[model samples]
Target: MRRGARYRWVVLAVATFTQAASGFFVQGIGAMGIQLQRELGLSTAQLGLLVSAAQFVPLVGLLVAGELLDRCDERWVVGAGAGVVAVALGAGALVPGYAGLLAVLLVVGAGYSTVQPGGSKSVASWFHASQRGFAMGVRQAGLPLGAAFASAVLPLVAGAFGWRAALVTGGFVALLGAVAFMTLYRRPPGRAVLPRARTPRGVRMRLLREPAMVRTMLAGAGLISVQCGVGILTVLYLHEVAHAGAGAAALVLVATQGTGVLGRIALAAWSDRVGVGRQRAVVVCMVAVVAGMAVLLTPAGRSAAVACCAFLWLGFFGFGWYGPWVAQVTESAPPDRTGFALGLAMSVNQIAIVAVPPLLGLLKDLSGGFAPAWGLLIAMTLAALVASVRTGGARRSADPAPDRDEVACPS
Candidate 1:
């Protein structure tokens, strides 16, 4: 009977699957980017803008989706989101021009936003406080894991059947996963589940005034600056700078993503032991990111292997901060306000993602390479580190006892 209660594992698994599905669905764009540019006759700026369009829609979606997750059934809300993403991707595959592509990605991104907060809230509900970081790590790792899967497969699919065919294939896979999640995904059985609490209408204003939360959110956004810059440009950098073949560049993405999976899980789980708060851990991670960018600055030569190794290290730390940082955010949030806090944080993240890439890409365009652009990223990481230092020392809180009586074991 002790072992049988492990249905929580099933819940975690499906949630991971859904998050990973989103990754596979979006990562396809990056993998097929070069092909899409050629087929559509897009400039580098235009290509970056298309990728940004897919990323930008999630900001609005996240704001609204968080509210929905707080008030609605997870299964139904997520199921509907899944359907929207599937249809959006299917339409995206059929787009005849850049405008049509942007419109489709907007719809797809809205669908993408629903799964994240819903999955996160569900994980927080099912796990006890002590187990929260690992649970979140498992779920967060899905993003990179899914991206890795997509990066590996999508290029080949496009090579074989054209980019449109690859997009349609990805859409079909997402739709199938959505149907499965709707069918098999169950809330933990027999818990006396309470509706997620509501924040007052003025809570947004109140939260904006929160120095600690504000500092943390700003710090988090800064760290993600590196991720946004790297995600969009790393492939181009490899192709253009290192003169790597398409297969080789895709492998670099795989390496970057694969290490990030470990980094996300390992860093979060490490925070559980190291006795440092999430803020300091993030500062330390960003410092490593700065060093990774420095390594990239070195000339591409026999040392290129060293640069790849540096990227793996950088990738590990670059995207790894999210799990632990988000764990802290959720842990700090008032129970009723978890959804709002997370929503606002994601909104801030989306803004960084949307706002930063184009500026950095423009730097690349004007400078005729990425040296100046990467320098700007290093500056962003330094800014994040400063933000981390500005947040004062932590307050201690006792762990609450696990709610063993909350739910019966699933039979």
Candidate 2:
């Protein structure tokens, strides 16, 4: 039992590392935007599409990944998917032109679609309800942690060896992560047995009709829009509007993602204290993100210090909110359905993720300022906050029992 207890933490560590490695390249795109723009002579909208391209396939791919996880071992599914990311990015290094890069990222996105849900399902299967929030938070933190690491280092890598070398570097990191997970990962005891039969589609579809599920899905859309906006535009806004240098702006983006890592763990730990009631924590994050965006709309956002603080605030609440939000999602699933629930809910979120960055970039281009873009995020977050509050009564009554089926490795 002592040895068994220790393995869960090992699972968490491996899941987190693989998740980070899988997303390393795409997460650094915003930091590389200016350089790519200079070299390729691309417009802001084009750069935004570059970010969106990686997210676009996930809309459908997540659902597929979720179904795959329910039937297969997460180890093979996740490791293979991440290996695809490494290969695609390595090939992308040799490909020239903006279109080729987009094509490469689309394949990368297809691969990454497995990592998030696969990692989440893997961690959720290992931890129980009482501590699941924190576990999920730590796992989710991998995305921002990877992004933050890449944001800081990739720019320097690109500066010295060119962008192609940076791509190759991401490929190498992902390859190492893939090999590690495949070698070390094992299914928890009892989960080694496969399901006797596949879950029916109708039963899975019923999740969409649940009031709590619908509310959580809506909230995720708004929150993800805010996340996408910040990830894609923070550096650009700092560089163009605040007159910060490229290095400084990218560093601020790094800070933004760094705070996100802290916020995910902090907020998730807070949710564990709050018990199974998780959406309230998400509401708090939504309100905080709205306030951060409001600050950015004011003249204070132009000051380098103020803008950095605002981005940190946004990063903390904006990106951090996923801990409780995802906890709520897993908790809300029907018996044996955590993977599908997470995938379905997050796949719905991919719509906003795919649309918001390019749309925000277009807004920036049209308004010639950041105000309108920030305002849109504020509006979306406010709507989410209100929806969450209105559905609080439902969430209170909607707590489902933990799923009995754990994700297992296939023999």
Candidate 3:
């Protein structure tokens, strides 16, 4: 293989590993929910808040991380950010109460805000347009892969050593990821070597106004809501509604997340061959999510075997959609602004990620069942499907004019 080709794969491997490590603790939280409630005396909302607190800082931090990636080497930005995550989680192991855990997670979120955009930027820099979707899929798969690993392990750790030890173990894993990334990562050859400079506020605001950008943000709001709901509520729902044991319920979450890893890769590779490409792939995933949620509402879905299948389907489509969706966002940006575009788009997603979990938990608390929560996801995903079709068609016609300022980068 050519040296450039070989190096890009190396970059992909590093990006995937670091992303997995960074997300380890947060992803495991759902599996530990029952344990946390038992030990910490957490109400449903409080448990949901623990998830939301990690996401809250990303609303702004992603924008900053995006801007930094546009200016600096991803090696420093991504590596240092993962280091911060490790440090914060390590600190969290010693904190005394729910409030203290929330404070530590806020810091972890601040650090993590850098990892997603930074890893995407790094991988996007290395791959060409033709293969970018697949590459992005593999990179984004890290989250679910990390969550799967966490789901399998963290609950067991909490069971034996307590939840604090699980947090500490996650910290060590993140620390190793940081060291590996910093040691091995390099910038793609022939990319611009400009002095670090901020993206102008005017330029940032203008990118937000682009049709593709607006559509992506809106779609992300709904899709991410579904994803967050599945992440935070799936185990709880299975335990409470399906009468599954905590271990079985946690394993269901693991199955869902594990399937998501394959879903991202498969869907993204499919995008590379499709007619309308990534946007259409996202729409298809949305439709699948709606169908999956609808299945959850049916009587057949109450059967443990069927309910597991339903959630596995939701995991595949709901979480899998991000690969193509993110590919579309990166492709939509002007070459120089991919990082900013991703950051801006994901920052919008942060709103949904932070709000959905607690809100869904509230719905469950009020209704005394999972039906309302599943219905809400179904409705949200259906709306996103409609928006994607309309905006995607419109974007093709409007694409030539709105992005006149964008200069295509050499591949």
What C-alpha lDDT do the candidate models reach, one value each? 0.74, 0.86, 0.86
Q: Write the per-residue lDDT of candidate 1 for residues 28-119, one digit (tens) a residue.
A: 56666677777788666776676677778778888787777767767777777877888888887778777887787777778887877777
Report the C-alpha lDDT of model 3 over 230-274, residue by residue, as the tens digit: 988888888887899999999999999999999999999899888
Question: TM-scores of the models, in the given order?
Answer: 0.92, 0.95, 0.95
**After superposition on all CA atoms, how large is the RMSD of candidate 1?**
2.6
Residue-by-residue lDDT tens digits, candidate 2, 1-411: 557667889999999999888889888988988887887888878888988899999999999888888878889999999999899999989898888989988998998888898889888877877678899899999989999999998888988888888889999888877887888877777765466355577867778878788889989999999999999899999998789999999999999999999999999889988744787688889989999999888888888889899999999999998888888888788646777888999999999988988889899888888889999999998987787778766734355553452222111
| Stretches > 4 Å off in candidate 1 | 1-4, 189-198, 300-302, 394-411
The count of backbone overlaps in candidate 1 is 0
What lDDT score is found at residue 323 in candidate 2?
A: 83
Backbone clash total, candidate 2: 0
After superposition, which runs of candidate 2 have C-alpha atoms over 4 Å from their true positions? 196-199, 395-411
lDDT, model 2, position 57:
93
- When superposed on Cα atoms, how far off is each prediction in RMSD? 2.6, 2.5, 2.8
